[model samples]
Target chain A: MPTIWVYAEIDNGKLDPSSLELATKARELGDVEAVVLGPGATEAAARLGEYGAEIVYASDDQVYADYVAQPHVHALTELIGENAPDMILFAMNYDSRDIAGRLSARLGSTLMSNVLEIESVERAKTAIIGGTIIVDVALEGAPKILLARAKSFVAEPLEGGEATVVPVETTVPEEAKRAKRVERHEEAATGPKLEDAPVVLSGGRGLQGPDNFKHLEDLASAIGNTAVGATRAVVDAGWVPYSYQIGQTGKTVKPSVYIAFGVSGATQHIVGMKGAKRIIAINKDEEAPIFQISDLGVVGDALKIIPQLIEEVKSRKG
Target chain B: MNIAVCVKHIPDPNVPPQMDGKYLKREGIQGVLDPGDEFGVEAGLLLKEAHGGEVTLVSMGPAAAQEAIRRGLSMGADKGVLVTDDTLKGADALVTARVLAAAIKKAGQFDLVVAGVESTDGYTGTMPGSLAELLDLPQVTFAKTIEVTDGTVKVNRQTAEGYHVVECSLPALLTVTAGVNEPRYASFKGIMAAKKKPVETWSVADLGLAGEDVAIKQDVAGQTPAEERKAGEVITDDGSAAKRIADFLQEAKVI
Candidate 1:
């Protein structure tokens, strides 16, 4: 069987959900092994095993404590050289992107980012030009790197055997440690993370202003496991933080259900969420491009329909 | 502190890019500076103002890429450098990073290099890290706020849960996210002043590199338009749109 190596990330002594999601996809391609870095990563191996990681290769050293991407690059590159995995997968995050790029340079290999699907064991697909075009990419080398978009694959836990933990030893280059961590300011997440949210309610310039975003928030609250997002229009207008922007230039999300409110389905915005399993678009303009891809299109003013939808959802639960 | 900001010239995303057969058609599309690079340029300028140094703009593209560098120069950068080569077309991110690293090395000593989190066109968000690794410098990315002092750089890097305060020494590389600051519009006087600024143009040979050194390794076997979703049921309500949506949600087993 083809062996796939997943770059697992550890957060607060637990395996990151996105990393586990990568494992979930990696196992489908072949024998799934996880390469985890930093302190406390070994502790998360059991959880990684539950999510389809057959073997956990871990590196926990002082040089990795600072969260620099280079150290992991040094460690993982050595591991990949020792055991030549057919494919390597990573979550599409800051550290993973950095590491993949550097590793690709080191190995003289190809790194494909924002990947949506595994077309086969060798080929994958990604959206280009803000989702207006989808391109199938083929990597020509062993140990090809694939950075999957956030939430592209669901993290499913299976009842299976524990992963055999293997410790890998490597030296961190002095230059990699040049970057240090002084402080960590945690922005208390108000609700479910957008990537993990099962349902996403997004707004755009069609909402008129920032204040209208509250309607989507209320609707999100009504539907548990929901998060709020905005199009680049609202983000550029300074109405919402860039963290909440979902578009070609923003975060690519693949929630189970995506509800676009007052969003005009610009290809820029569509590229981000078009991977959603079910898309529901609400807009007054009947010809909005968003409706073209939506599973359910509602032609009406969102300001009027949102409140009613929230009430209906709440009443149904009651 | 001497700073280098990497910028990209891309076809205006506001205008839909056309496709000639399977490739992106760039002949008629207007090229502009990638929007994300504005924040990088702004951050470099701010660092220069506070620390008292020069901010040099570096870019790799065809002749028209000079337009992007000039825009940065107009935004208060001291000078600009453009790396243009006929053989550099279709170069991937790793190759591009190598070229940029070579250019930065030739530009002389720099305390810091800044870049946008990702280019709107390529959207890989990997160049800065690749460049950092190639240059053997510390790299920090997704900075929401950046402060430089005492030969050190500290940034509040954004995260899924919140943010982290990452610190690195001078001679580091940082990739800033949007919302870090509001980039200023170039004043008329600044625009006129930019015309006289010296912009050094270089070829691949000047960087002491052959075409194969920065050649793209991946092959695009083929590109087809993404599959379109089928026409779905549209409900235009006079007054019952909400009820229909509620029912539809229930029928779809989503509510």
Candidate 2:
């Protein structure tokens, strides 16, 4: 069987959930190893064993002591060369993506991101295309790289397995110290919680300005529990956070119900929300690309249409 | 200073997202620069152009993602690298970051690495912070503006509540939000320049990563499409349009 590797993340001795999911997916393809880095990774290594990692690769060197890319690169790259696993699994985190990208580029295999399921083990060589998720690509290669979204894979519990925690020490390049950690201030997320929200209500440049979102919000409020999003134009205009923008550059989501207000439907915007099941769009421009894919279309001014739709829904329910 | 920017090629979402069962069917779609990441790429290019340094666009997701890097190069990056390994297919956020970290280190030197705060397809939005943790790189997430002078970086960041300023040294990791700079479109000349740039390809082993290193840490619990949105019947023309509209809302319990 192929050896599948997952980048098991350890922070203060706890394993991150995304890594666990990658471990689970890796198990499907072949034997699994959970790779951990940093001083606290020992605790994380043991936890990974409990979760089902057949082997734990731990790197705790001065360079890796604090989570620098150079050492992790040194350790993991060396590890991949030594083990020759058939598959590599990683979460779609920032560093994970870069590492995967770098590795894939070096290895000459395709890296697929935001994957939802495993169609078949035979097709592990293939890359997944688009957000709707339909293909299992089997590339002709010894080892391939795979990236899964955090919540997209369902990790099953393993009966009983002890992961082999192996401590790894690698040399830290002089440049490793160039990047250091500073303080991070997290803001309370308000506008739209994309990952957790079931429905999303988005506004585009067609809305004209931020104040117009008041009406779009009225519709969202009527829907209740839906998060709000924006197009790049609005996000660039300072109407919303870059986090809320949806398109080629923004967040790609698969919501159950997505309502596009005043969006003239750019192709970039469409890629982000196309996975949504039910697409409802209201735009004065019926020819907007968004209308082409929308399950339901209302040709009218979004500002006018949204409030009226909100009122109509309220009146109907009452 | 040397900088690296990670970019991905994504299908245009404005078109019908072709699907086969649970898979997103990627065919016949134009791959373009992930608009979200364009901000990050633009940030890197502008910094390099102003600061007199090299900007390497690293695309490790898939061979297809190289297109995105070419787009970045056209925007004025110095070089390009594409890491293509099948093992990276469907990798979760953690492995994705690890692979990137591996590539960045092996690529030799970089004072900074920038990426879009989040990818357009994954929408996890956790990678930036997670990357900071993994890379141990001082980071500024959701940066709106970044001004670097004499190796000291000053940034205007977008918090969920409002914007804030952050200062840091060089050789850090940063996740950029939109408005870090208005991403400039590629002119014909710029496009030609990208073709003249160099693109290096690497593999998992080439970057010094063992094949069976990182394992899955979490499962994708479940994915339910956005909740169904019911469309209220349209009542147009006639004197009854307003009444019908009102009646629909009353029945739907909106008002």
Weakest lDDT window of 10 consecutive positions for candidate 2 chain B: B232-241
Give one digit per residue, the lDDT tens place, for model 2 in B1-255: 799998877666455555434434433466677788888888887887787889888777667777888888888888988888877665655566777777777776888888886666555454554455455666655577787888777666553334456566766778787666878888899999999999988887787777544443333333444333343333222333334434433443334
Query: On residues A1-318, what C-alpha lDDT tens digit does candidate 2 reach at each position?
Result: 777778865544556677877776667777888788876787777677766788898865434534334456556777888888776777655446545644554444445555555544335321223322333444445565666655555567687867888777566666444433333344455645775577788898888888888776677677676788888779888886656767544566677777788888764476567767667677777577666667666677666666666766666555
Q: Could you tell me the TM-score of candidate 2?
A: 0.61
Best by TM-score: 1
RMSD for each of the candidates: 3.1, 8.8
For model 1, the stretches where C-alpha displacement exceeds 4 angstroms are A28-30, A50-52, A119-122, A154-162, A190-193, A205-211, A223-225, A231-253, A264-271, A283-289, A297-301, A311-318, B232-241
What is candidate 2's CAPRI-style docking category based on DockQ? incorrect
Residue-level lDDT of model 1, residues A1-318, one tens digit each, is: 999888987655656678888888887788999988877888888788898888999867756667578788888878888899988898877667778877877776777777888866679888776565678776676778888876788888867747999997777777667777667655454798886687888998789988988888888888787889998768767787667878655677787788898999765577679888888888989988788888889898898888888888999978
User: What are the candidates' individual DockQ scores?
Assistant: 0.52, 0.11
What's the fnat for candidate 1, on a 0 to 1 scale?
Answer: 0.63
Angstrom error at residue A137, model 1: 2.5
lDDT of each structure? 0.82, 0.66
